[model samples]
Target: MAHKKLQRFQEIKTFPNVFEMPENMAQRWTKHFNNQHPLVLELACGKGEYTVGLARLYPENNYIGVDIKGNRIWRGALTALNEDLHNVAFLRTPIEQIQQYFFPNSVDAIWITFPDPQLRLSKAKKRLTHPRFLRLYQQILQPNGVVYLKTDSPNLYQFTKTVINLFGLELLQDYDNLYAATNLLPEHTIKTHYEQLDIAQSNRIHFLAFKLNQTLPIEKDVELKKLIEIHGTD
Candidate 1:
């Protein structure tokens, strides 16, 4: 497994769809896709399933899968190239630095599928939906640009709700059990390997779609910390 991982890491460097911290990446995006289509990002896109899936569903839009693991992205990059998914691309970078690669108001939407819940209170800041990450998302996301979260973790679902409420973000949609809900869209149909494993063992998938506020206040972060300390049981 180690040898295979090393080989994939070396191989992805040559892939036309993969970019690893390339300088002035924001300027190159338009040239890469050769169109002025809307940009959508799938953060923590393990295997780039959602990224590729969304691109396939919406040919009018461009999708980029952002993850730090090269070996994991190799499968999606290869699949995109093999299938000629011109709208699909992969970026190798930590989610924390996501804003650095995209210019202000450049991103149209974001999807975070099956990300780590960061159940421990001590790790709350690391959660993708945390205020810290939201601030980063706000930097690049267009005004009222939607952010979607799909997870099997009840804790994460509730935690994100708290952040949205506390931060005054617009909650466009919320579903505690996505499969049990009606009028599901095409994007909801895509599932990753981790989702199949049911790692959370919660059986139900939670989904939240929201828009960030114009500004995520710094003072509210202090309040958020206090609330988590008092009420956070996970």
Candidate 2:
């Protein structure tokens, strides 16, 4: 690792708001925030712009940014500490192991911001919107809890919508051109570094929010698989 990254890794260890493989964390986030506020998770939270931004917007709900990279987490954790954002925290761990850390129905909502599109069919399972990953999310998410996705790739946006339809998941909002809307929410206008870069490159940013109330069995859905295999090429 670079010198700066090593320094950040060491620094994050000292932050009381940051946890690395903590135990007794399941359904116990209320103790961390010192209130019974609902918890929201930002997965694959690179630099945690969403975590910091949303925490500022809604202090009533606690926010935790989860990513395997300690260096990226350092920025958000330190910012929360410095700003005295009590509702903000960072979890340094792989998103795949989330069930081990959080109990069922512990989370109120999820946000996956600007994640890699995982454009290839072979890498479909790695996409955060993939059924396997959704199942992992549902394990800890409360019933009817929303999972939000904000991304620069149009492919991921459409792909997630298709998956939601095929799996009978509720599609609460679908903004193909999120910024084009006349009445945009505050969260929609909060741009991340990647979002700014995408705008400069003329790549459209997409947003999708849905509820995973029912089971999403990708194996049984032949049509969805073929759709992925076909449309995943672009």
- What TM-score would each prediction reach against the true structure? 0.98, 0.94
Best-performing candidate as measured by TM-score: 1
Give the per-residue lDDT of model 2 (tens digit) for 1-234. Answer: 699999998999999999997888775677778897888999999888899999999989999999999999998888888899999999988888988888898899999998888877677778899888999999999997999999888778878988898888898888888888887889877777678777425356778899998887667456777987776622
Task: Give me the runs in candidate 2 sitting further than 4 Å from their true place.
Answer: 199-202, 232-234
Residue 182 in model 2: shift from native, Å? 1.2
Q: Write the per-residue lDDT of candidate 1 for residues 154-200, one digit (tens) a residue.
A: 98998898898887889999999999988899999799987998999
TM-score of 1: 0.98
Clashing pairs in 1: none
Off by over 4 Å in 1: none
